[model samples]
Target chain A: MMTRRIIYLDNAATTFPKPEGVIRAVEECMRYRGGNPGRSSHSVSVAAAQTVYSARAAIASMCGAEPERVAFTLNATYALNLAIKGLVRPYSHVVISNIEHNSVLRPVSSLSSMKTDYSLFDVVGKAQGDTEGVLASLKSALRGNTGAVVVCHRSNTLPVEAPLEAIGELCRKKGLTFIVDASQSFGCVETDIEKCGISALCAPFHKGLYGPQGGGFAAFGKSVSDREIRTIMQGGSGSASSEVSMPGYLPERLEAGTVPTPAIAGALAGAEFVKRQGASRIDRYERELVEYMKKRLSRFDKVKVYFPERSCGGILLFNAEGFSGEELAAALDKRGICVRSGLHCSPLSHRVNNTLSCGAVRASVSAFNSYSDVDAFADSLSAVLSLR
Target chain B: MKKCYVSMSTMTLAQKARNILALNKIKANVVKLTVDQSYGGCSWGVETDCDDQEKIRRILDISDIPGYRFIRGKE
Candidate 1:
């Protein structure tokens, strides 16, 4: 059967229909600048290195971070793994938020085998704008062995954001490292390294940044030292090949094995696009879309809305009364409306929301999405509410 | 364009030197020094127009990358 017009609303998974010039940049890199970056010093390699350098500068300038501090990885999952494993060792303690994505939770959990202990708590206080409550939970969780605090800057399910600066301040007061998982919020939110006091940030260029898949990064703050975090993986870093040990510099230290030149090239374009568009613009646009979708969906009698007080970017979580989350999503899909259903890979968040059994539908937006797209989604939801 | 090669003993120094030049608005090209017949070491060289020779030399000096050398163009 022929599908109706498809309106993509699953940008939180990974942005579709990347912005202008991004595809061209990736194609150019694959065609002409395919040399392995920092691996060789041939003419093509020089050009590739330049492309990588330019991308770093773009991301750093946007994040208010130094270019040398940013290291590209396969995706946010790998980046988060590097940060968590690097910081926590055996007998160390860590504090993670309930709002964390699996990317952060799985890595922290893996450290359990290494004898690392972590406390899992909720971000509702921060989500609801209760600053004191937010601080209190963090304060209570910190102990002598608690070396770090990891949190999701924004909740992907509810699309709600916490005050990163305040969270960072709490971590600072306790002398603990602050790691932010920005997989769902990075380019579309305010995440300046200095302002947020983030010791390390893991984000996907393929998500809010609007690049092709396979591009992710972990950018560290100025005070963070390579000596504090040991390398978890080791491979050819191009530099210091004479030495058997991995190079212990910022980018090269964390970046093990062959760097993906084309992916990095696409990410460079994505970073440039976000830079040009400005964070506030993207944030405002996405905010409007989320608010619009939520308002429209709330009008239906059968629609049961599950949302936070205020969300920073694009997302609306809700479920129709008679329809299971998956059933409603399938009906919408038949009508050419795409969205996410189920626990969204964060069972802790679902349990905290008291919807672990019946997951809510997550409809997220992006810069490419228009209000008309939201209208289409709203209409589709209204039609399919009784179908299941 | 006339060219000169700034050769370093290792890859890191070569990359650092090249980045510095690029940040300063100089169009510097990095080439593997091992490809050269006269150069046998596995290092890198930043190739730039001869007009940038003095500027490149100055920046290389300030960067203080140890054992860095310069190879000028024949023409």
Candidate 2:
């Protein structure tokens, strides 16, 4: 029996049908270049280390940072945890946005036990593309003891984009460290760490870069010294082995144990793919598809589109009149249509959008998705909702 | 020609140093130090035939490569 094709619309969780180059890179790394990086001096090990270095350089170049400043992790959550738990002072406070994922929310919430308090600032005027409201709300939320400002660059469930430049400027003016969670925005948006004055920009490769899971990074800016950010996990960094503590540098300071070489090699290819295709070109195309999806789905009377004006063109959220988001998703799933439903591991966003009760259905697009894919998804969703 | 080893903290740094030196008309090989030469269990360095400490130091300083030490010995 031939396997039915899946219509994957869950790019926010992780992009599917990765680029051919990315898949080939991973296979080649595992087949021919399988060696322990940064651990030995053998030719095989040296070659592996070189491949990893190339990946680091790619990630750094994309973020406008030095190669040594990028530290690899399992995913964006670990990277965000490193940035938040590492930078926030014990007695100081932090300011975060209202639509943060649990990655940011849980870490900040956990920090409260250590007397590290946090406050939330709404991304005001996000729908209108106005930064002044966000700046004003952020200023109002600031306290004298606020040492860091963490914001999600894009909401995973909605298209809410926090004003990075405005928030970065405010943080700089207030003498605060700015940490950005770019989990949902990295490859889909253009970002320059130096220009934006971001202290640490954390993101994963699986979601937008079209790489396999198990690889992510936190790229630190020049303003952040090695000693300023502490290490949450410590192990053999393949550097300064004699020292009892972790190395006093970037990359090695935060990166402990063995990094996933195959995953990183694939991520490097993914980054290269994005570079070749042009991030702006990809963004424009995906936005067009999202606009088409929004218009097509809204033609049905029972479909109530949520945040129609707030989306930054990557993700769309909606619900049918009488069907819960989960039920609609289940019905669609039976038809081989893949979409995420419920809270989307982002209760904070649900609460803000008044979707905390039944949750919202999220259909995220990627550079690979086309108008046909969107049409199929709409037809399947319509069929699912009509059953009510 | 005398060969000398420039010890670096990590393999990434050693590789970076090799690339930097190559661009400046210098040839260097990344090598692993033996147990006796290894500072902390295992260490990495770049081996270069040009042993002029002053010239190498100047080049490294200009490139801003950090935390490297020169140890003179035969591999």
What is every candidate's C-alpha DockQ against the true complex, given to 2 decimals? 0.23, 0.60
Candidate 2 lDDT over A191-254, as tens digits, reads 9999999999999989878899999999999889998898999999886788898888778889
Which regions of candidate 1 are displaced past 4 Å?
Answer: A1-3, B1-19, B22-75
Docking class of 2: medium
Best by DockQ: 2
Q: TM-score for all predictions?
A: 0.89, 0.96
Model 2 misses residue A131 by how many Å?
A: 0.6
lDDT of each candidate versus the true structure: 0.80, 0.87
Q: Provide a comma-separated list of chain B TM-scores, one per candidate.
A: 0.80, 0.86
Kindly state the number of residue pairs that clash in model 2: 0
